[model samples]
Target: MKIVIAGGSGFIGGKLVDLLVKNGHEVIILTRSKKTPSKNVSYILWLQEGAVPENELHKVDAFINLAGVSINDGRWTPKHQQQIYNSRMTATDELVRIISAMEVKPSVLINASAIGIYPASYNTVFTEKSAEIASDFLAQTVKDWELKANHVTQFGVRTVFTRFGVVLGREGGALPLMALPYKLFVGGKVGGGKQWVSWVHVEDVVRAIYFALQNDQLQGPVNVTAPTPVTMEEFGKMIGSVLKRPHWLPVPSFAMKLALGRKSKLVLEGQHVLPKVLMANEFIFNFPELKLALEDLL
Candidate 1:
């Protein structure tokens, strides 16, 4: 299959591209960069305002829309908030509009969504069929994002709304950044550490994407997390053990709030999400346990 990834250069998208290519599938990466030369993989330049190149839309067998502004990039200023919304809404609107106009559209449209679509902290288990969107910064952003991507279904296309957890094992993802505190021997739970940390290996994430792509029956919001979801304390211990560092020092919630401001929920709080859709489909995960996943990375 010829796959076109909108944000193929980023963390999860890049990993997916590598796996797709090695699996003997052709890939075309669309970015903000100038046109370059490559084999099997082609590069096309895309921007928020301009139109997608005509041939580029009709050339691929699948379209994976991962283009968006990093929600975790900066402080939650009003301007930054607009950047977060515009980056996702604009890109998704364009992708949906383009695909709707295609003469022979791709069979699948996998738009990247986040587990933030659920309430940040919940005792009740959340599943694909559940609707528990937290009325906060991240939830509102992801909710609107998914709603926009759902528009493609009107055109008779299979739409997969992937709700991702914290992805680990990739070079620059949570592993490297989270390992820093452990390597310094001051790693410990954030806040009280009781918050659940739902996570998955980068490889498993891409695999789930393909599973959704192939399984036309899987539609709507699907949780793309490892079957095992651990608390922040256990997660910190996994990192500490991998780095062989003492994790006794604890960071208080006030410290986190001071540092992260409103975005502290990304770290201090989490959701215990189960990949109900993937598990029901019997999709196998390469790294379901956190220890081996950290070992593979750290």
Candidate 2:
């Protein structure tokens, strides 16, 4: 399979590309910058405004649309929120435009969504079947972002949306930042420590991407989290233990609220999500337990 990853140079996408290449698939990565190529990887400069470079479209078997802005990159100021919205919508729109114009479009499109589409509350266990999205910044952003990709289904391509959990990994996702305070022994619980943290190991996330692509029956939103969901407090302790550190320090709710403003849900709260679709489809997790996952990554 020849796969084109819209944002494949980053952490999760890069890892997935490595595996795809190892499995004898040709991969092309779309980047915003001009750079030299690496072994078995080709980088194409993608200007989201115009049509995709026609030379890169030949014989493209699948398109993995994982391109998006980080929702937690900075303070979610009204201005920054607009950047988040525009960056995602623009990239997604361009991906759709390019793929739609292909004489032989990719067989499948795996779009990335988040569990953030669910309310960041412990009051519910969110499944792929859940409806009525939460009315929050993340919810609104993901809802619009996903709708843009789902439109590609009209081109007769199978579209699969992976509503991700807190992706626990070693590289530049959220784990590296989480390790900072913990390394100093200030690693403590955020908010009440009761909020559910649905998480998946980075390897599992990469593996799940291929699993979804290979299985033609997969469509719609699929939760990419572990089978067991842990609370914030439990997560903190497990991580601390894995790193051989103390987990006594606690960051208060007031501090978190002040730090993040309306975007405090990134840490202050999270939903209990279940990977119903992935499991029902017979997907096996490499690191299903938090301790095991953290130990491997740490």
Candidate 3:
């Protein structure tokens, strides 16, 4: 399959591209800058002034949109928040236009989504079937993002919104910063630690995307989380155990709010999300347990 990926340079996108290439698929990465082409991979310039990426792209089998501003980049000021929302909307809007112009539209479009769409709750478990939508900034962003991507389905493209949880890996995502406190031996539960942490290994994230690509029956929203979800306190303890460090020195919720402002919600609050769609389809997780995942990454 020939797959075209937007935001292919991102943390998850990079890994996904690697997996697609390794599986003998031709990959085209849409980027703002020019890059030297490699075997089974090429780059196409997009999201720029006077650039028509659709003209250069042809016979694209699959389209994956992972383009967006990172919510973890810094404090969510009004300007930064607008950037986060605009980035995703602009990227998806462009993809829709490009697909509309295509003589042969791609079979599937797997847009990157987030579990943040679900309201943060300690006891409430969310799956793809959950209809309760959170009104928070991140949740609203995801909701609107998915709505934009849904336009692709009108072109007869099978759209899949992979609502990702906290993706854990060595290079990027939330692992390094979360583990840093433990490495310095001051790590403990953040806030009450009762908030759920629905996490999945980066490898599993990549594999799940691949699985969705192959499974024609899969469409719409798919929770790309692990079967087992842990609370923040349990998560910290597992990290400490994996690193052989002491899980002491609790950080108060006020301290986190003071430090991260609105972004503190990323850690101080979470949802108990499960990948029910993946499980029902018999998708296997490479690192299902938090300890095993932490050991592998940390």
Candidate 4:
């Protein structure tokens, strides 16, 4: 299969590309910069002036859109928030246009989504079937992003919105920062520590995308979190245990709000998301337990 991935240079995208290539699939990465092509991988310039990426492609089997500004990059100023929203909308719009122009559209489009679409609740467990949507900034961004990506279904392409949870990995995502406090022996509960943290290993995230590509029955929003969801307190202790550090010193919620502003919601609040679709589809998780996942990544 020849797969085209927008924002293929990103954290999760980089790992996904490696997995696809390792599995003997031809991978085309759409990026803003040029990269030297490898044996089973090629990088095509997109989102740049005078670059006709669609013209440089043929019979693309799958299209994965992971393009977006990182919400964790900086404080959520109005300008930064706009950039976050615009980046996803623009990339997805371009993907729709490119797919429309294609003579043979891909079989499936796996758009990167977030579990933030679900409202943050301690007791409420959310799955793909959950219809209650949050009105927060991140949730709204995800909702609109998914709506934009949904346009590809009109082109007869199966669309899957992989709503990712807190992707825990060594290189990127939320692990390093979260583990830093523990490493310094000052990590304990953040905020109330009761807020749920639905985390999945980065490897599981990549594998889930691969599974979505192969499974025809998968469509619409699919939660890409682990089977077990832990509270923030449990998460911190697990990290300490894995790293052999001490989980002490609690950070108050007000301090976090003052420091991170609206971005504080990323840690101070969370949803207990479950991978219902993946489980029903018989997808096996490489690192299902948080302790095991932390040990592997640490």
lDDT of each: 0.83, 0.86, 0.94, 0.94
Q: What TM-score does prediction 4 earn?
A: 0.98
Q: Which candidate has the top score in TM-score? A: 3
Candidate 4, overall lDDT? 0.94
TM-scores vs. true structure, each candidate = 0.95, 0.95, 0.99, 0.98
Tens digit per residue, CA lDDT, model 1, 19-132: 888888888887776767566678876663574654565556788988887765677777888888898998888788778778888888899999987886747678888866
Q: Output the worst ten-in-a-row residue range by lDDT, candidate 3.
A: 289-298
Compute the lDDT of residue 190 as modeled in candidate 2: 84
Predicted candidate 4 versus true structure: per-residue lDDT over 1-298, tens digit per residue:
9999998888999999999999999999998988899999999988899988889889899999999998878899899999999999999999999999988899999999999999989889898999999999999999999999999999999999999999998989999989998888889989999999999999999999999999999999999999999999999989988888888899999999998988999999999999999999999999999988998999
Pairs that collide in candidate 3 are none
State residue 258's C-alpha deviation in candidate 3, in Å: 1.3
- The pairs that clash in candidate 1 are none
Q: Regarding lDDT, does 2 or 3 come out ahead?
A: 3
Off by over 4 Å in 1: 48-51
Residue 249, model 3, lDDT: 88
Scored against the true structure, residue 192 in model 4 reaches a CA lDDT of: 98
